[model samples]
Target: MGPDQALYVVATPIGNLADMVPRAVEVLQCADLVAAEDTRHSQRLFSHFDIDTPLVAYHDHSDDQRTARIIERLEAGETVALISDAGTPLISDPGYRLVREARNRGIRVVPVPGACAFVAALSAAGLPSDRFTFEGFLPAKSGARARTLEQLAGEERTMVFYEAPHRVADTLDAMAEAFGEHREAVIARELTKAFETFHMAPLAELAAWVRADSNQQRGEIVLMVRGAERKAGATLDDESQRVMKLLMAELPPKRAAAVAAEITGVNKKVLYNWGLEQK
Candidate 1:
């Protein structure tokens, strides 16, 4: 059997129809079967591209038997393409079980990579991208979500999260609290679509803005938070703290942080954050 016998993990567009990659189209058209997160949702995509391949429902809920059937088809020399409702398969979506089992069975698993909302958002987010973490969607409950963010309190690498439209406001407030209200964060909403927007600000400010503007809460949201700054050098000495406090009483926080950094040899941003905490 040739490549057609293997399992194909295809990436569909996140929002823009034009984001669909050509190779993905060819694979979907040629595959013997397409297992989708939602067959009904995938049908619209297939219709747009005039692809009439057989469809089957596969999602996080798909049982072992469903996966076994797909694997058997692949083993029997029938190519099967796995796709999510949108974006790349298995990125906070389903198909992990099928993909892992396929590899275990020594079936060739090919990737048709394309649009990924978090990656696309991170690219234009203006956050430090050299190193980062993808923290998918946070827990919906306040207690679990708070605990989750608390674990990342010291995360120095940029952090990315996917948030539901309904829970956006609550998540932002929770993030601001756990990560420090002054921490920098970016909200990328409705990416790759006509009304797409990217809003960057401090966590507290971003949360406030999103709360005041109902429109920002209505679409797909990718939240990018600047990592906790590593405070280089030793902890602040008594003299430095004394001077910073005195300076803050007289000058603005920015100027106080600058002057304190000069005298204390600590990061100005660090001093600024300390001042914020002290307030």
Candidate 2:
């Protein structure tokens, strides 16, 4: 809006052009400059929208000199728009440094959000969304990826990640090996495009599906995994205490067992028996 006094982090469509928000287009068109992950990619987008703002490259591989140039622009009272090749910038993309620098200089940062693959997949994943974590892109090397997965083995919140087509199968295999074959997962591909597809199944089945069909291995992928189902820090004895407290509230033993099972996904029959033992 009103001549943005700082950096504008704009989100473009991941695949479909129509998903680009009008406010994003206006900011990109009117900004003093547009810093993109790839100048060539941004150029194409700009051409399509007939927005001729100057383009500069700012990516993971770029040098400090490039970031310095962008910071200088913002310091000089210029409103710069930062965008990624697709989707939102700085979500496993660059622009963090520029934003940080601008903030240190007291520049305002405006985020125009739209068309995030992770959010899209999560919303349709039918998984628990109340608590979740985004892991962005995983490490490319096998050992690093394995170690990463092992660290998240006990995590309880749903996790989201982005994986390239070439490595999707391998990543799934690694996940299965680290997390277990029966772990639930969903893979969303070519999102918001003509051939968009969502594939959901156990980890092993998904691995096999990707292996059996070459076509399934193409296009960007958003992978969602159900977090490990684990009890809280409380032990079996602590659970017994919690159940006792609830039962004391006059909730029937069967209803108490059902509620406890729903809370922990523990065996309802076992909990019911425990309730009897307590009584």
True lDDT of residue 106, candidate 2 = 85
Best by lDDT: 1
> After superposition, which runs of candidate 1 have C-alpha atoms over 4 Å from their true positions?
1-3, 233-279
Query: Residues 1-279, candidate 1, lDDT per residue (tens digit)?
Result: 224678999999989999999899999999999999999998899999999999999998889999999999989989999999999999999999999999999999999999999999999999999999999999989988986786686678999999999999899899888889999999999999999999999999999999999999998899999998786544567887898999999876657989999988888877876765565
TM-score of 2: 0.82
TM-score of each: 0.83, 0.82
What total of clashing residue pairs does each candidate reach? 0, 0
Any idea what lDDT model 2 has?
Answer: 0.85
RMSD of each: 8.3, 9.2
lDDT of 2 at 87: 93
